[model samples]
Target: MKRDQARRAYWSQNLRYLAGLLLVWFAVSFGAGILLVEELDQLRVFGFKLGFWFAQQGAIYAFVVLILVYVVLMNRLDRRYSRDEEDPA
Candidate 1:
């Protein structure tokens, strides 16, 4: 593939992954925590309110996981796209 085309493809992949992750983060943090707190509160985990826990701690953990996932994926993408340049004797 052409260099510009390859670069665009890589960027599109990266953006799509990032956007999906952010969407999940938003859904869990805001949607479940604030919008559906009452329903979530009906469920309990070890006596902790599900919605409150998500708002305070779960979202933070999810963000950390997202960072790790991005780092790993970027590393793989970099390796996959790296130029195989070698000197010809």
Candidate 2:
């Protein structure tokens, strides 16, 4: 593909991935934490209250996971797209 076409393709893929990630983040944080708290609270993970834990800690953990995931994913993407700067030969 031409440079412009390659650039557009790169951005399109990035945006699609970002959208999906954000959707999952919102679902885990808002859905489990607030919207479905009552239902989630009844369920237990390691004998802990799911909803309360999600509200208090899970969201933050998920956010951190998201950040790490994004960093790793973007690094791969950059390499795939040949966007990363090369060292002087």
Candidate 3:
């Protein structure tokens, strides 16, 4: 019973993390690359327009970063949940 609840809670938290991370990825890939491109274009990076950079490369970088972040978070979550149900409470 307690173990089942702990498992559910762990899964719930995992989904929450996934949702939040994916939202960040969407914001970077779609929002920055498409929605705010014009505003970002006014700036520059490495001789490229910021918006263009984001569209071409920055989004990729953000994705990589977000992936690393997700890995770290999930590892912590895994560690937290690996213990007995008592610790989960």
Give lDDT per model, in order: 0.79, 0.85, 0.91
RMSD (Cα, Å) for all candidates, in order, is: 3.3, 3.9, 2.0
What lDDT would candidate 2 get against the real structure?
A: 0.85
Tens digits of per-residue lDDT for model 2 on 7-65?
A: 78779989988998999899889899999999999989987799999999899999999
> Can you tell me which runs of candidate 2 are displaced by over 4 Å?
83-89
TM-score of each: 0.83, 0.85, 0.87
Q: List the candidate numbers ranked by lDDT, top first.
A: 3, 2, 1
Better of 1 and 2 by TM-score: 2
Over the stretch 1-89, how does candidate 1's per-residue lDDT look in tens digits?
Answer: 36666678778888988898889888888888788888888889987889888887887888889889889998988776565222122
Q: Write the per-residue lDDT of candidate 3 for residues 19-78, one digit (tens) a residue.
A: 999999999889999999999999988999999899999999999999999999989988
* Ranked by TM-score, top first: 3, 2, 1
Model 1 ranges off by over 4 Å: 83-89
- In angstroms, what RMSD does candidate 2 have relative to the true structure? 3.9
Poorest stretch of ten by lDDT in candidate 2: 80-89
